[model samples]
Target: MFSYCTDPDTLSGFSWLSCYLTTGKHMAFYRAFGTVLLLLAITAPTALAFGFCGARAARSQVAPLRWFGKIYIAIVRGVPDIAFFLFFVIALDQAFEWLRHQVKCPDWDEPIRQGNDFVVCQIAKMPLGNAPQWVHETYGFFLAILTFAIVFGAFAANILYGAMNTVPHAQMETAEAYGMNRKQAFWRVMVPQMWVYALPGLSNLWMVLIKATPLLFLLGVEDIVYWARELGGSKTARFSDYPHPDWRMWYFLALLVFYLGFTKVSEVVLDRLMTRLTRGQATMGGEAQRKAAA
Candidate 1:
């Protein structure tokens, strides 16, 4: 905070507002935007990896693998995304601690689950009780990313699985006729064409993912929404550098603009990507490109 912030009551106009927005807490608030971006950066690729694995498994010749893949897609899709987010974070957290407890406190005889409380031996805590604050925050961020990956992975798998099916069987047969092995045919022939089909669904999923970033608050991460509430709430002289009336509506309006601008930019990028992927493919997009060039 500025020197003026030392006496918020005495300051007015831009001086007061500047001091208020630069408080230590407000700095944290500003950093929360980065938290959102970091989550997306880490989660998107992890989610894509998960989806790719699930899609490949679903198409595997092994019956067990196929069944497992199908079940994963079904269970995740059947539940509401928000419900899954709430449920999985808890389940996964407990699961990690439970496994740790088994390893770390095998000799302990007390029940881990008693009433509403879950007690694990001190060493079994995910970060251990003595772990630093940064460790705790990092662990929580990891779980949030995993939860997002699991949920969005299912959606991506469905899109990719359908895309795989949409690839012409004749193309596969032609690859075989040319003496290409199944794996070679898949990598060289099927994968390329599948993108032409997958991009639209993947684009929609990307938009949904952007919209869902606010759920980071539910995961207990101090995301942008969390900061918006903390900084925008009415502050009293007793609790703030520059006390002000509630301005949460204005804060949320800014968020609205941020998302709308981001999504529009994403649309433009995805459109360009679609055009590039569709080029020279036997699709309507390619046809249009050829006619335009003519």
Candidate 2:
């Protein structure tokens, strides 16, 4: 960006490095970091909501709802996660386009799948072919978020279901004795107390979620991994400025450090949160906290 950066060929040492890092593509690389954070921000709560509903269904008194929940958890857990990621992105995309095709081109007489190609009318194309580049990117990111949520939600549901059961049976009994209905007891007594049990599992899930962010590359989102591979590859004289040898190892090393730092910060925060949530509860951690305060 500097005036002197006009001649990168003459630039050397830190000057060349500075000009190289400040290029437009590097700016995009920096923005991709925020995209990773954005994915985490959107996915975490959505996954939790999905998990909550799944857990509630699993615990439902109705037979069908309970079975549905059990099937969801079992099916997701049975398959490798990468398989789901690959399958769901394409599946969800086609499902959306199919709905659009049905709505927009109701009279069209063509099968959506002709051999290996998934063809829909131009209007049914996701984000439309004429749409801005950002629209395409945003659509891809949204699909990635949905994939992450669906996969993580099943695991979170299993954790939450177990946590709900770990809540003492007598607590519900006391709530019922006080004339509260099942739903009231569940909300006012069981749900409130289950977090202490669930925190450890949820914390572990959070770390897994963090590690899984790299999978965004597989879904075609321009995530850090994609940018790392792009920016770290060897550049010849035929290319524009900022030529460099293959530095993917160093780029990946930076990613490793970033993830390690993120996990370390998360661990510290989760520990404090666990301590806070556990305090005054009728659990071992609560007992220890009480003793320490005394």
Candidate 3:
């Protein structure tokens, strides 16, 4: 804010605009962009790890493990993402609190589920009653990350499983012929080769994940979308120093430009990654690269 920001009545044009953009709420709006970026950075890798585990489990020699992985993939991929987001957050939150309640209040004679209310001991609360604002926000963000990971991870698992199968059987046989065991062949041969096949699907998944960041508002994270809607709504002179007509359309347009630009950058990066992964390999992409170089 500027020193002249103290008197909004006399401020006009660029002066008013600068002061408006530098308000406490506007600073929060700026920070919300970072929140979205951080969510993507953290969730992408965590989701990939989850998918890797699920994919490996689906292909496991043990029937129980394989069945578990198949069921997980089927259930998650089949469910609507919005429905999953709504249901899973509450379920996961309650599950955590319930576990904590059992440990922290072993002698309590009350049932956790009393009609519609799910009650827990104060100490068992996720952030606790006395916890600071950041702790509550962090807890909500953590839940959002987990929910996003579980949903996206299932789709990633399916993509990876198919990619693993697309690697030629002869490659595995050759590894075995060279005295490598199944695990060694998998890690050294199949896994390395699968990325070329998997990249396209994973790239699309990444885009979907980017679009899905708005769902953070549903989980109470006060993300970019939340801030945009809040700040863009019409504010009256009675409510605050700055008053304006509804500007939600402009705010949403800004969001549109942001997502479009972000996706464009992502496409460029993924293309380069695909090119690097395909070079010198046996796939069609590699074959094309070879011909181009020649």
Q: Best candidate per TM-score, number? A: 3
Q: Give one digit per residue, the lDDT tens place, for model 1 in 59-159.
A: 99999999989987787755678999999899999999999999989999999999999999999999888889999999999999999999999888988
Candidate 2 residue lDDT tens string, 91-180: 999999999999999998988889989999999999799999989988999999999999999999999999999999999899999999
What's the true lDDT of residue 166 in model 2? 96
Candidate 3 lands at a TM-score of 0.97
lDDT of 1 at 214: 96
lDDT of 1: 0.90
The C-alpha stretches of model 3 lying farther than 4 A from their native spots are none
Order of models, best lDDT first:
3, 2, 1
TM-score of each: 0.95, 0.95, 0.97
| Model 3 per-residue lDDT tens digits across residues 1-294 | 789999998999999999999999999999999999999999999999899999999999999999999988898755678999999899999999999999999998898889999999899999899999989989999999999999889989999999999999998999999999988999999988898899999999999999999889999899888999999999999997899999999999999999999999999999999898988988888999999999
**Pairs that collide, model 3:** none
CA deviation > 4 Å runs, candidate 1: 1-7
Regions of candidate 2 where Cα sits further than 4 Å from its true position? none
Error of 1 at 185 (Å): 1.7
